[model samples]
Target: MKKSYPFLVLVFFSSCWSYSQSIATSPYSLYGLGSLYESNFGLTAALGTAGIALPSEEFINNKNAASLVNIPANNFFFEIGGTGIQSSFEDNVRKENRNNFQFSHMAFAFPITARSAFNLSLMPYSSSSFKISGLKIPIIDGNNEYYYLNVIGTGGLNNLDLSYAYRLNNKLSLALSASVLFGNTTDERTYSISSSTTSIDKKVNYSGIRPILSSQYKMTSSLTFGLNVKSPTRINANKVQSVTVENGSGSSFLETDKKSDIDDFYLPLDIGVGISKSFKNKFNVTLDYEKSYWDSTNQSDMYASFSDQEKFSFGLSYQKAKTARNYFNRIKYAMGAHYDTGYLEIDNKKIDDKNLSVGVSLPLDHLSSSLYISYTYGSKGQITNSLIQENYHKLTLNLNLDGIWFVRKKLE
Candidate 1:
């Protein structure tokens, strides 16, 4: 335990810095918020699960506001969940992992004036937590701990959005929402050399803001269309520095010394369409197509740069009327798929990966309780570039809980 104290201190105290941004630069800064939520089953069912324009009817599906319109009137909603990632790199050289938990959304919807309903929600717009570790065996020395590198980071971007929906005719509904995003990130790392009591420690801190617009249109009782446009955003990370030591006698610290431009670049653009059909109100099948505009993002101050091609996806669900104990609600089974051309480019070659997942959801009475569990597997195919060709597989588990509190109204 005493030997590991220095490494822990290095990881915790190093993340204090800032950077600049600009519009002419790449909008890749948006990727820093965190990995989007993708269920193992959802990856196989749709395009990254990012283009959901409408909400679900049984509950607030987290995909679109349109799904909220189907919710029972005069009821509130809330949701919370967490995800874990266990990843591996090529040749077993690099490994990244993390376990994270957060609240997804909290909102209440009720009739305002006429046929219109308004919902105000506090939810996580984005989030990310990942770690990387590598070990090197000395060719000359036989030390058990020759070389080690450890990187750790944790933070999230969130937003408060206002949504409204109006029932036009019987078979058609339209909805719109506006959201603002705010979040920050902190990263720390330690590198040790072989045959010497020397090491280097680094730290970084960053923050930013973004605005988003989303909407959905229902064409028929069994079909719906979704659309979302996220404007350009900029993240500024400043006060970067590096610390080096030799023989544990003296310490030297140096500032990163790089100046940044603070401007906004359009984040990736996303579009998708979905169709669902119900059989005797017992079971339903849903299919969708999504396109992500990674080309719009040209640069990033926090991560590597690349051209991410558009991706594709699909999904299916089975629901039944079943009862459980006080904690259990209705049970639902779901499966999905997702594919994307990675955003980073090496040697002008595009990187890509695919995902597969399955999940189960439980609806708790009017209180709105739910639980979903999924796992994902991804591999980066060889690109045209000549660099460290690496591929990885990630396992993710997500758990969620949602409920509402009424100050004056009667319970359902």
Candidate 2:
């Protein structure tokens, strides 16, 4: 067979240096961090992102690093995925529709030794590209008088992870990883009076590094438990700005490309736990729960606030057997559900999300490679006088390929 790793490498490097487009267009992206993103890998997206306790034997598990230790000996794995989202936003006044497509992730993994493995991947950490025109804001002590503001925002952040896992024995495994977070966001605002308009342009650059720890224990031959922790971090920020004003009398520049210091963004601690169980070698189920202490970060946006967040997900899969004589019987089918009490609070209302997904994994040749296709439908926020609700449909495609390494050729 032809080599697959080379194609994966090319796709990987191209994605790393490519950042000219926005990954998210949600209006809520106008808030802090521009709508933080979690890029799913392998079968995780189809499994409602509940793979913290899954092994890396058949595919790479990006949720928990400890899963890497399960990589089969003398085997290599590569995965590339992308997503398409169609959404409708509704409010009391009007409705809008939009569509977006973007690459999700590119990752590769391999065994380092009999009981150890390593992985490297690049994906978006967050994205924001939004427009708000004629947003009326009441001026302080203005007695019901308000000013209309027009704003546009764009940009996001990217994350690069270096992970290593080691299996202490057949029942327990541990892993550690460090991730680099870097990116920038830009915003342009314009406010107008009867004869004059003022514009302010600002760009913020951010950079930081966070470390993660993960563990997995095989409680029984059919059950596995897992945990992962992400330490709190501070991302340094610098702002570049310019301001201009125009009136009937004249047009003038108040500032031009001015650089200044700003308060750094602080990410709160995050923790998660999960379990995976198998029954009769044919069916499997996985469940996960997670929490983020955003309230502790004490961060607030001009229009929103942060709060503690909670999330839960579960998945069920069916497969006749990995070695089933019939190709159809060997195919894997899965379905899952997810809920998240989002961290952002706008207008004193928490923006929450819920979704369901179904997928099928089609085996390729006799090797442990497969193609994954999944569909997800979800909604976020609630429709009210001050807030808009978003309903979205997402489709994901993942190409997972495998190869054998360090094997001596017999006929070549």
Candidate 3:
């Protein structure tokens, strides 16, 4: 217990430090708030971010808060994770590569009573970091005439969630969570013509609060069902701007340090459902589907249009019963796939994503502690005259630690 508290504190501070240095290298994050970060806690990432129906008997499940009620009594769980990605982006005429690393999430959960539990997590909600240089845009009405545009963007929103779950009966559990999102983004754009260049730099600040409701029902000893809903929210926004121009003449500041209220960003309502089934004692399967009503948000982007989005995830795992001598019996192997019909439409084309993952969890000790390692190969967008396709390989690593509390030492 003594060591556990200090470890938790260390993880908390470490996440804060990582947040300050985080950067997303995906070019597709240029729209809206940026790319929505998937906080795949524990081995969920290895399972293609499925498992909304899995219980928390042995490990933490951040997807469905109601699973917290399944946490073992007198147990304390903590998890932290990170990802490294190598990505390639290509279009009709250009191809480039990039590599980077980012922190995933930090979370901890503990039992409040025999039938209730509490959890807290820190994670990135979205990322807007992107870089584009000298993109040519043709004039709307002029023939064979074009203008050059350059853009650099950074920063994104972060989410801090507090969740509570209570078991209503032997087979049913309910949970509620409060998610606070706050962040700022900086966008710098430069436009150039024959002999003149103009620059506009602005920082957008955003803040919002969202509520999530979740439930889990154990239909049988080996089967479970889950559902979750996230209410729509309005994120207030403000911007600070500075503009400058440079040509053959000396550079001059047209505006500096101007601040004003901007349009609020509206989030779409999201809902998901999932099921899990175990085969014998060796194999488990989970399937999930989710939908987001982005069109209802009525938000508009200069380069894209919002539409309804759908996501699907499927996973399977194999584990053997514990054995005294064979260490291989203690490890678990998993594989899964995920697909998303993206919400953004560029030039009437759907910007979609699909991925496959494989992972293994190694036992750290006789207890529930484990080391999770996962590898994912994924792609998003498509090569078109106006769109760039992205392919990426991601490696994820996390440590999940379990501790026994309020128990006397037997050896001493």
TM-score of each: 0.64, 0.92, 0.91
Considering summed lDDT, which 10 consecutive residues are worst modelled in model 1?
Answer: 17-26
lDDT per residue, candidate 1, 1-412, as tens digits?
Answer: 0111112212212222122111101112223344443322112222235336434644444455545556555455444333444333222133322232333345555544344556666665444444445534343444554566655555555566677766665555556766555555455556667533333333334455444444556666555666545545555544344455554555654434334333443356555566655555445566556566666676543323545456555666665554545434357676667777766543344556677756666554534445555554555544222322233333333333333334377789
Ordering by TM-score: 2, 3, 1
Q: What's the CA error at residue 242 for candidate 1, in Å?
A: 6.8
User: Can you write out model 3's per-residue Cα lDDT over 260-303, one digit (the tens) per residue?
Assistant: 99999998999999999999878999999999999899877866
User: Deviation in angstroms for 175 in model 2?
Assistant: 0.8
Root-mean-square deviation (CA) per prediction: 9.4, 8.9, 9.1
**Best model number under TM-score:** 2
Q: Mind giving the per-residue lDDT tens digits that candidate 2 earns over 21-90?
A: 7767777787778888888877778788898887647888999999998888888999899998888777
The local distance difference test score of each candidate is 0.47, 0.84, 0.84
- Segments in model 1 whose C-alpha atoms lie over 4 Å from true places: 1-55, 92-162, 166-174, 187-209, 236-266, 300-304, 320-330, 366-368, 375-412
After the best TM-score superposition of candidate 1, give how far the Cα of residue 132 lies from its true spot, in angstroms. 7.0
Model 1 earns a TM-score of 0.64
Off by over 4 Å in 3: 1-23, 143-146, 247-251, 322-325, 408-412
Candidate 2: lDDT over CA atoms? 0.84
